[model samples]
Target: MVSDPVQQPHVPVLLRPILANVAPVTGTWIDGTFGAGGYTRGLLDAGATRVVGIDQDPLAIEMAQPWAGQYGDRLTIVQDNFANLDTVAGENCPEGVDGIVLDLGVSSMQLDLAERGFSFLRDGPLDMRMSQSGPSAADLVNTLEEGPLADILYLYGEERASRRIARAIARERAVEPITTTLRLAKIIEGCLPRAKPGQSHPATRSFQALRIAVNDEYGALAEGLMAAERALKPGGILAVVSFHSIEDRMVKRFFQLRAGGTGNANRYAPQLEEESPAFTQKTRKGIGPDDEELEINPRSRSARLRIGYRTDAPADDIDRAALGMPGAGDRKGRKG
Candidate 1:
């Protein structure tokens, strides 16, 4: 049986910065990721009149049953991806929302459960589907071609040993299906050097790549940013917290592009037309965990928070390439 996530306490990362930057949080707010109900609860406590919590994982919605009723009508929980947050907002907050909070990447609650297979340390089934349906990590490891698999590890995870790892996976899977977390982790460990003190696990990159592929996380994030633009009222706030460099890059590029900062870095290059800024940011460099947060939650070291306030400018179409998504401009993507 799977262990209950509630058994392990979850500490929301950068919650203080989000509340501070988007101060006096009011009106309807949407917690796009809604993992562990941390942001949702925080928003409500911080003065939001109403909060909509959205999550792709059914287990998340199911697990909230015990505490969800405490908020009464002030909190609404929905089962869906944040990419469709605008659609969900249309039905819930037709007038648009005052704020939206997105905590990207896998949640700690999900990682703690051995059955979720998000962590190699736990040694669970090789299933890493955030939505708990469709293709899983095992499916890709077993069936995907070495080239595509390598692309996923290299591009998505930024794993330099991608080719070597893929070759090992291919060889090991041929002998027997890579059906468990430890078995696949062993394969990746064989390819990469053992970690030094305080370094991440050898299988970290491979697991991250597989999870992203299985959940279509990058595609969802690209769409979700656009949806937030359309769904926010003028002066509304959108706060995003991202983990890892790839996710931070995408968020940084999205904020820069939407704020009309997208331009040729070359001083001599011809200037491209800039769109009317849809959002404005106070922190151009983004915010990270302070010393206090670091002392309390060591996992937050990689987390970065970016804030954007919506303007009255009309929502516009954004090319996926503009956001620096892994498989975007190069047109090289991983697929089964």
Candidate 2:
């Protein structure tokens, strides 16, 4: 049986910086990626009047029920993706939210549960669906063409030997379907060299690539950022904690463009008209975990936090290309 995510111990990453930057949290807030209820609880404890916790995973909502009642009406749980946060907030809060917090990527709870199939360390079915629906990692591994599979590994995971690993997967799956975590890990391991001390596992990149593809994480993130802009009230705080370089890059660029910081980096490019900035950047650069957080949770090493405050200007459409979102064409094995 799957365990309760809320009951499980999870330290919210960059909680200190988030709270400090978005200080005096008084109005209703929305925890967009309400995994394990860590950020929601933290916000409530930090003096928020109310918090709407949103999660795509049913398990998170189910787990939250046992503890959510303690706050009575102050805490509301919604079953939906953050990409639809604006709609969810309108239906639940209606007045618009004063703050929004998004902690991106898979949660520690999902990774710890073997049956959830997010981790390669413990063997389980190769299912990496965040919403617990749609095509699973097993399906992608067993069915996708070698070229596409290679593309996912290369573009999503930044694996240098993606072609080699993809060839190995194709060769193995033809004999029998790759259906389990250990089975897939073993295949990837065979393609890569043994890891040195302190190095990540051989299957790390392949597993990450498969998980991102299975969940359409990048697509969700791009849409969710825009959704947050629409959902937040003027002067509202938007705090986002991202893990890994790809995620950080997207968040950084999103804030930059929304704050009217974007322009042609090339000196020869023609000057462009400036639009009203939507948000004011709170942090000039991404904030990483402090030493105390690092000591408490080593996984926070790759974490980065970026924050912005919504301006009175109306929300504007963002050029997805400007946000550094990896193109779908990249997944189709197209060379730019």
Candidate 3:
């Protein structure tokens, strides 16, 4: 039997634009993130014959059971990361999938649960593992070198005071292990001036950095986009919704490269041969939530949706360096 959490409701961000852009949703579709079953349910309701729901979090898969059974065989929940989504879809669909939708970053469901420790607002264990296993935020905080820690803050969170925060963390952990969200938040808060009105908390960037490192989110996103390229059938649609600037930039570049929109970075640099375009840009620009959506869910404010349609050409490997993926050199010690 399915255990539905009625108390925890999640409204999928930018559902309208996704549906409108990829009109006539039919055949099999994969909801790569599958948080709270919002997109999966949306696809099924919109006319998809079958929807395969994939999520790294066991809790997300488990929470889906309640309404999932109603869809019966139409919805298949997989306990895996979307980076391997091609293999999962191949095993289940066999004919390939018609559409793939990825909603990146921490889910609303996870953020609300204090025990999950995704939010700095409430105190909880500093374990932000989406899979609920492996090395956690606490592990990185209490053990990672100040250099790598600072790099993660700077590159992943775009934190300007990364070095200072890392130094503070190094000093704090010497006195006591950073074990909870509140403790880490307090340490980060100490590194910066108090927030002015309408400003985000001082710990916001550090927490975002730690969460990205703990989950290897950027790595997953890079691989997952390529996996989508491999899994999508010709004419299939790939839609991604990102919550922050870094994520949005990655998605924009992926589509640009795949669609042959990117040219030489420097005019003097010899032009490199271009590969066959693998995707056609479906949305010329990133789509944002309308005011109605913002009025309904303010969390959608930062969300941006970008989409592309697969071409008949075979999928090729994308150079990570070209995609602006944050690297070890992003650390202060390494040379470019």
Candidate 4:
């Protein structure tokens, strides 16, 4: 993997916009997915007296520790998934944070390290665990039944050829267990019809699906959102930069429900509002990276950021059924 930046890479996608929206300068803050501590550094530079950095990847935590020392008690890094942000933050910053920032999806460092098995473009092990301990992609593809396998590809990858791919996987794994990234990528590609000249690689979607399933990315996102809600004080800001449709939709719904408040769909029925809405929408619409940033960081192209301010209400259970988002049970394995 690339060493710590000689300079910042592409300005940490939507940094300026998030700074403007969240205004994280003079209080405790949380950089929930502290990939390389870019956002945390920015927050501290903005005058935040204390910032807690949380990440599932131990490597990220290691990298962030030095920054904590440099910041001299103003910064601390925790090794854990952002889903546990509430507990972690309460322990680290009992006062609660003024702002929380989450930059979702695979980090550049993770994808850049071929040995980590995160990107199909760089063949490595079939493992895709962000924490490097949970089920690997190989484990899922070789062990899951065809039906559930198909569901994972369909739901997480959003691939249309889910059934065909899953069937091919089952057939191949019956002969031998899928073991490596390249092997699985090849199996996914072989299951597809020949691509047209301008079409994308057939394995793209299936690989993505397996990675998401292996890491439970969406599940973590949902839990992290709820945790952030619990960790923030009233008027505290929450900012998220999502990379895909699934994540973007989840964040959109979460912000809308918390900020807009609950109400009855039927006009004839009596409507009830909580003592206080959980949050207020800070950004009327999700913001994207500017053209200049996109030009330098292609990965920033897919990022969509939404910001919200916590309201004076207690945190509530996330309505997974209503949100159409995955649950922890769903993240443990394949789901079509």
Clashes of each: 0, 0, 0, 4
Give per-residue CA lDDT, model 1, range 103-152, as digits (tens): 99999889988899899988789999999989999999999998888888
Q: Write the per-residue lDDT of candidate 2 for residues 11-66, one digit (tens) a residue.
A: 99999889998888789999999999999999999999999999999888887877
C-alpha local distance difference test of each model: 0.88, 0.87, 0.87, 0.79
Name the best candidate (by lDDT).
1
- Candidate 2 has an lDDT of 0.87
TM-score of each: 0.94, 0.94, 0.94, 0.88
- Model 4 earns a TM-score of 0.88
Which whole-number lDDT from 0 to 100 does residue 188 have in model 4? 77
Of 1 and 3, the candidate ahead on lDDT is 1
Where model 2 places Cα greater than 4 Å from the true spot, the runs are 1-8, 264-273, 328-336
Error of 1 at 300 (Å): 0.6
List, residue by residue over 1-336, the lDDT tens digit for candidate 3. Answer: 223333745789999999999999899999999989899999999999999999999998777766788998998999899999999998888767999999999988888877888889988899989998899999998899988888888899888888899899999999999999999999888888899998999988888888999899998999999999999999999999999998898898889888986564334434446888999985579999999999988989999999999999999877666666766565554222
